[model samples]
Structure formats: structure tokens, C-alpha cells
Target: MNYLDRKYQATMSVHQLSILLQYSNQDVFQLGNFVPLTALSLPTIIRAAKALVETGFLISNEKDLTELSVLTLNTSFNSKRINVKVALPQSSKPQEKEAEATCNTLMQDRKYYMECTIVRIMKARKVMKHNLLVEEVLKQTQSRFFPDVQFIKKNIEALIDKLYIQRTDQNDEYEYIS
Candidate 1:
């Protein structure tokens, strides 16, 4: 069998063991519990349980496995093994481009938001000083996000370039082009 098939089988064995433990009324697993709660055949449960016991994730009383034999979960071993697995990096796929795309999209969205906020404030106020506009933008957008002054200034320049607003004689004040 391939490595992936073996891994899948091992994962399924662990999954089945967990389901059995969760459904069983008593701390120990019994044949009667498996028969009523799950559609899995008796042979399948026995095989998985035996595999779990061999892997130190389960304990069984019988030297010879059987449907009637009781089994217990080995929680410490399970936790230790899980911790070891978590400590190991699972970087099977390359993710750098995905992360870069996400970051680029976020930056574009933020820039759009800043531009919209500047336009909205200018439209409402008709004319506003640069410092006041920046403060108002910060106050209005703070709940959604805290924007940097430089980014806000950049958006303000973009709005001017788009002819949505214009700088007044004072240079610090902006007049909405309406």
C-alpha cells in the first residue's frame, strides 16, 4: 500500500477509537455498546481497536482479542503523541503567494475605505482644514480600524487628483468640488 493509504487507515483507526470511547456509557469499551450504536461490522471495530492498542493509544485486557474483551483509552499516550505531531511543521504546500495575495487585497480595500471616508467627510463639511479632516477620519474609522496618518494623507492626495476635492488658497484647507 502507498504511504497516503497507510496514513488514512491509521487516521481512521484513531477516529473510530475516539467515536467508540465517546459513545460507550462506561469508561471501558464493550462489545454490546459497539453493536447498538454503530453500523460498523464487529470485525472492523476489532481490527481498529487492535491497531490502536498496538500503537499505545488504547489498552485491552485480553491477550487474545475478541468481541467480548473490554478496552480502555490511553489518554496520556494520545496526548503525548498529539503534542509531538503538533510540534512538527506540516508545510506540505507552498503558501507564500497566498499570503501575499491576501495582504495585497487587504491593502487595496483599506486604501479604498480611506478614500471613501475622505470624500464623505468633505461632502458633508463642504470645506475642511487638513488637520481637522485627518482627525475626523480617524474618529469615524476608529471603530472599524485605526488608519495611519500617512495613509490618510495619501488618500487625500488621491481624492484631489480624482477632482473630488480641491485645496484652497490656505493649502491646509480643502474645498469639496461637488
Candidate 2:
């Protein structure tokens, strides 16, 4: 299993947590079945440390030189790790409301197009390598929309130009782009 799965399954005792916070050597000590703290396993330590902070036990003295040194050493050991920080974007109330409205409109339009018959046909034939002959594609289109072949062809061409479908030749066999 991955680190995330292991973390989810972790259940440490209060004594183990206290050891981690109180002893300097505890920085490298094994806690339960956790992996040893090393260059390759630093993220696990960082995650556990953050969990301690979340539970109000691991307070940092941001202005302390010793704290800065520890942080610098930890960062150097885990150079490739990423820390996820989520923050809401700063925007005026009206601008935030407008953005939400625009997102809703786009989502609704996407849902409408997904239910359209033409989209279904395109989705069904997404893996064809060559252009499907007009006659062959028309038979499938007929079952869905009952439109004339020419009309279906025009609609297919428009969809292709709009990047919804990919057409490889003069004939109408098409594939969905997504």
C-alpha cells in the first residue's frame, strides 16, 4: 500500500506522540510501524508532524533560530516533496458571484450537449481510424435523429470544425475527440 493508505490506517498512542514532541532524538525515532525518517521518507514525518499540529500539540516558534535550522534541514532532505496549501482567491464579492454564475452556465450547456443524439453517435464511434463512409454513418444517424443524409453530413462537418469530432478523410466516418 501507499503512504496515504498507511497514514489512513495509522492509530498512534498518546505516549508515542508525546515522545515525538518532547525528545530531539525522537525526530529520527520509529513511531509504531512508521518508516524511518530519511531523505526518501521525510514526507511521512512531515505529514505526521502536521497531524500533531492539527491536534494542537506541535506548536512552532517561528522566530526561533533553532526552529529555522530544523525546518531548513527537513526541507533539504525532502527536496522533491510538495506541500498542498488551499486558499480562496481574493476577489470582490460581486466578482466572485459573477464567476460562480458563469461556471454554472457552462456546466448546464455541457450537460445539454452530452444528452444530444449527435453527441451520442460521435461518442459511440470514437475509435475508428478511417473516415466512415457517408452511407454507413447515415444508417446509425438515422436510428437516432431520422434526418436526411445530407443534413446529418452538414451537422457532422460543423461538429468536426468545432473540434467535437475528428474526421480524417472526405468520407464521413468520424471519431469523438474526447
Candidate 3:
């Protein structure tokens, strides 16, 4: 699953994250592991490493110069229902229930992106009917994931309640309030 959740606000760039994922399951890792990756700069790797620590994804340990800077995955980070994907060897597979749990978490993460897209569309349009809003939201988000129709309706209802939008007297159209 992608770790693009806006809630986490990852300070590390995608390449840095790729470097971090290289030692996903290892108990200890060295900073040198990132050197072979020609695309990323050393400073970027170091910043990403520090950001990961700040984000609670990794725990670092002081090490001798003979060894690469030691780091370990923070096990506590996984317990908060934040599913971070660690690369596993081909022979090992996650259990069925664990995979399902990951999927559920991924869906929730996508919902945030969808919500932002809807706001952008609605704020631009100012006023739109239910069907038109749904259509536009789907069309604009076609490159992303297909949203559930019920989910869109629920979001519309929520927007109305929050006064972000208002249902018109016609009962089918909504006008942006803010």
C-alpha cells in the first residue's frame, strides 16, 4: 500500500522513503546502505533518516565509524493502526487477516484524497446539483480511485451539515456557502 497519507505529512521525499524501505525488516541498518542508490544525494538520505525518526517510523542508535549508522524499525509505530509497508522476502507472506486489515487502512487513506478533490471541485463550481457534482467529482478523480456513490452522497450531506454547502429548496442541488 502507498504511504501517501496526508495526515502523516511525510517530510521525506519518495526517494528517501525508498532508501528507508530497503532495510524494512532488518533489526539494524547502516547509513551506507543508501550510498549505492545513485539517484539520491547523501544529504537527502540523512534528512529522510532524521524525518523518519521524528515520525516515529524508525529508532536510531549511536554506532562506531566502522559500522554504518545503526537504525531499527520502531515496532510501536505499527500498533497505532498506521500500516507501513515493509518489503518482505519472496518466501514470506503476510497472513490473510493482516492483509485485509492493511487494505482497510489503505481505503481510509484514499478517502482523505477524495475529500480534498471534492472540496476543490465544489469550491470552484460554487453551486451544483447532486448528480452534476457527483459526475464532476468522478471525472476529475478518474486518474485516482473510483469513489463509492454512497460515499459521495454522505460527503455531500456532511458538507451541508457543516455549512460548507447548502441544499437548495429543490432538494437535489447544493450551493457552496464558504
Candidate 4:
């Protein structure tokens, strides 16, 4: 295993190196393999390759002007022991996408108020059909502003996820939990 100076790590960020480590399968890898699998540029890839060579982590077989040559990892290097934090692109992460899809996607105050109206209505009417429930929730909250059926639907799904309400044996019917 190579013990690279942390200062050498500055040549390319740990995240970039981690990316290289991720797609590299065998000891000797062709240059094109990484370009399709990762966002690393030619310069960064060359730099990382050089740094790994300097650290004794990899052995470069060839270096060409137009394209990179094969490179090999040291036998002692283990990916699990790399211990570098790889940062994912912000928008690509599942949590961020989910939040964008639901939480931040809705108008908070309006969503909260609409959810309350739904609970209040469902409390009064224990069981309601899906279409009717949507209709009723919309009808009740109509005074505030017309809520999109889809937005109302998203809130209902969120409520169901929270266990505040559940769908009954009948397809469209929903019953309040409390």
C-alpha cells in the first residue's frame, strides 16, 4: 500500500481519487474506462495517475500524448482502507431529490393548512373514498386558495406515510388513524 503525503493529495481531491478507485476493476486499466464511468477530466486523471505512482500506489505502463496508457494498483491497496470521503453531487442524492419532490416542493404553510383540513374532515367522516376524499379536502380548503389535486394528493400520501391516515379495505376509502 502506498502512504501518500496528505500534501500530495492536494494534486487531486480525495473525492476525485475515490471516483477513480470506484470504477477501476483490475490492476491494469485502460484510460477510456474511466472517462465513460466518471466525470474526471484528462488532466485530473493524469495527475491522479502520477500521484499514485509517486506514492507507490500504482505503476504506469505507458504515457501517450493523445491518450492515457494502462495503470496498475499496488497489491496492498484496499478500497475499504482508502478512508476518503466521496462527496456526491448535491442534486443527484436521493434525500435531496426526495426533499425537492415533496417537502420543499410544496408551499409549507398552505400544505400544513391543507393537511389540517384533511385530518379535520377525515375525523368527521371516518371513511371516505379516494375521489370523494380528494373532492372533500379540496372543497374544504377551497376558500384559502384552489389547491391542485396533485398537490392535495401528495399531502395525502405524506399523511399516509406518517400513519395519520390509512386506506381501508375498499380501494378509494381512507380512515383516519386517530
Candidate 5:
């Protein structure tokens, strides 16, 4: 008897049966030709047992009925294994779209603020006294939309360190180095 023939009397859909077997929560049943039906629910055990019996792989005795059964493999076995397919469920939350919109808005706001500050600094550079003081720069840069003097000072220092602007004498009361 072939593996399929010995395991099943009828031509069962190996793929479907394999899937059902794989997901079954019970642990008493083992894979391969012989599998126990005791771990399965009554309906499933009955159906599976009936299927096996119909396929000629199993025989039930009149006495000592058992929920589990064992199958004998035949030498004519040809199939290696069966494959079961399952699909993944989709996500229900729309967080990705919301996050994207928030990120875009923040980026646009940052770009507008940076552009305004750059323009203000450039305009101030032209008329700034030859001796430019940090205080003077801070005052000139201050605006209703951007009043954080400390933040402005830190940004200017970073720009100087990066060579975008030059800083001369740190001790000088007033100086220019761009």
C-alpha cells in the first residue's frame, strides 16, 4: 500500500488535512502515518476517524473502541510531505497615516522658522556696527515669533563653529568676524 493509500482509504486533500492537523491545539497526536484522535474534539475526532476508515488506513474493532488510532505505513510510500497555506490578517489602526501628516507639518514649520531667521541675520549683517556684540545680535534677531534669546545665541555659536560664520575675540566687548 502507498503512504496515501495506507493512511487514507479515500483520496483526501492532503493539503487541507495537513493544515487542520498543524493548527490543532492538542498535543497527544504525532505527525506521520500514525496519529491519535483522542486530543481532538468529539466532532473533529469523529470526522477524522471516519475519513481514515473510509480511506482504508484504519480499522475499528467492535469492542474496546478507541478515540485514537494508529496507521501502518506501506513500502510503496511516494509523497514526502504536504504543505498548508495560511493568510495573515491586516492591521486595523491608521497610525501610520496620522504620523506621516504630523511629521510633514513639523518639517514645514521648522523650514519656515529657519528661513525667517536666516533672512533676518543677513539683513542685520549689512548695517551692524563694525564692533558687533553678542547682545546686539540677540536684540536684532528677537521677534514676536522668535523671542528665545538664549536659543538664538546657541544657534549663532553653532553656525560660527561650523565655519558658516566666523567668531573673532571672545573677550571683546564688541567684535565682528564673518
Candidate 6:
């Protein structure tokens, strides 16, 4: 007796719809009027009535109905199958992956910029103190981004690893390799 039952969706039983329609009889009637006619609970009948209201089978005095809410059959409405197309939302996983890749690329570019600044400063000075070199690198890279001293120090170590510079006997200074 299920009228419009679909998998994973709500439905109104045909018997419940018919009882409500038969009782309306071209005049407004309260939902409670059908409670005594059917073995179903009053709340169950109300739910069916609400489903019918959504399908244009019934017109109600209130959009949100209660047991005392008045309803009338929508006699003018033609009973026809409606084709509803629901559009599913796009997945966010791809977007999250793309954002993560972009962030990693930006970090790599920042690291490159810091290393370049270190090499450029060392090449120009030939020899410089560690703290002074760090300050100069910060000054040169500030127009693009403000790099921390720890990050500058890491880049300096990378330059030393690449043979672009070397730590002096002073231990607090660096000497350009070329």
C-alpha cells in the first residue's frame, strides 16, 4: 500500500493518502478527524499528510502541520509523475590536495630565495661575520618576505654544504669559496 516509496527516501502509504483524501470531501478538515478512521497513530497520519502536502495532493492551513492543522484536498492538482534531478556536491579531497601542493611549492620557493640571498651576500663581501651575514640576508630578502634568523642560518649551512661558502677559523664568520 506504499504510494511513493523510494529507496533512501520518505514515503506516504497509499491507504493513508486515500483515507485523508476521502475524508477531505471538498471541505477543509482537521488532521485529528482521520485518527479514529485508521489504526495508525495520530502522529503517523500527520506525517503522511505532510508528505501529501509536499506532493501537491493536499493544501494545508499551515506549512508546518500539527494534529489540529486544517487541510483540504488539492482537487485542481493533476496527479503526474515528476522527474527530480538532484545535483551532488563536488568532492573536497581534490581541492585539499591541490592546496597542499601549492603550499609545499611556496615553501620551496621561499627556501630558494633565502639561499640565493645568502650566496649573493657572501659573493659580494668575500668574508663576513655570522650575525652580520644573517642581518644582511634578512635586509635583502625583506622586500619579498621576512625570513627568520633560524631560517637564514639553515640556508647558510646549505650554502656551506654546496661549497659556495665556508665557515672561518673564527667559527663566528664565513668566507666565500669563489
> Judged by lDDT, which candidate is best?
6
lDDT scores in order: 0.71, 0.45, 0.66, 0.68, 0.43, 0.74
User: Residue 49 in candidate 4 has what lDDT?
Assistant: 53
On TM-score, the leading prediction is 1
Query: Which pairs clash in model 5?
Result: 8-55, 9-55, 9-56, 10-55
**TM-score per model over all chains:** 0.53, 0.27, 0.45, 0.41, 0.27, 0.50
**Residue pairs that clash (backbone atoms under 3 angstroms), model 2:** 132-173
Looking at candidate 3, the ten consecutive residues that score lowest on lDDT are: 84-93
Quality of model 2 by C-alpha lDDT: 0.45
Q: Give the 10-residue window scoring lowest on summed lDDT in candidate 4.
A: 1-10
Per-residue lDDT tens digits for candidate 2, residues 100-133, read 9999997555434432546666677664543344
Model 3 regions lying over 4 Å from their true place: 1-94
Q: Write the per-residue lDDT of candidate 3 for residues 47-153, one digit (tens) a residue.
A: 66666665567687652222257767665454344444333212224456778899999888777767777678879998788899999988977787888899888
Q: In candidate 3, residue 140 scores what lDDT?
A: 78
Give one digit per residue, the lDDT tens place, for model 5 in 79-122.
33333122222233556787888989975665456534543554
Q: Which residue pairs come into collision in candidate 3?
A: none
For model 1, residues 44-154, the per-residue Cα lDDT tens digits are 566666666666556887876687888776544533232222111223343677688899999999899888989999999999999999999999889888999998999
Question: Residue by residue across 38-95, what tens digits does model 6's lDDT show?
Answer: 6667756766777777766568869877888998866565433444222222347867
How does residue 13 of candidate 3 score in lDDT?
Answer: 60
Off by over 4 Å in 6: 1-90
Q: Candidate 5, which segments miss by more than 4 Å at Cα?
A: 1-112, 115-144, 170-178
TM-score of 5: 0.27
Q: Give lDDT tens digits, candidate 4, residues 53-102.
A: 55555656664412457766666544434453333223246667777778
TM-score of decoy 2: 0.27
103: Cα error in model 1, Å? 0.8
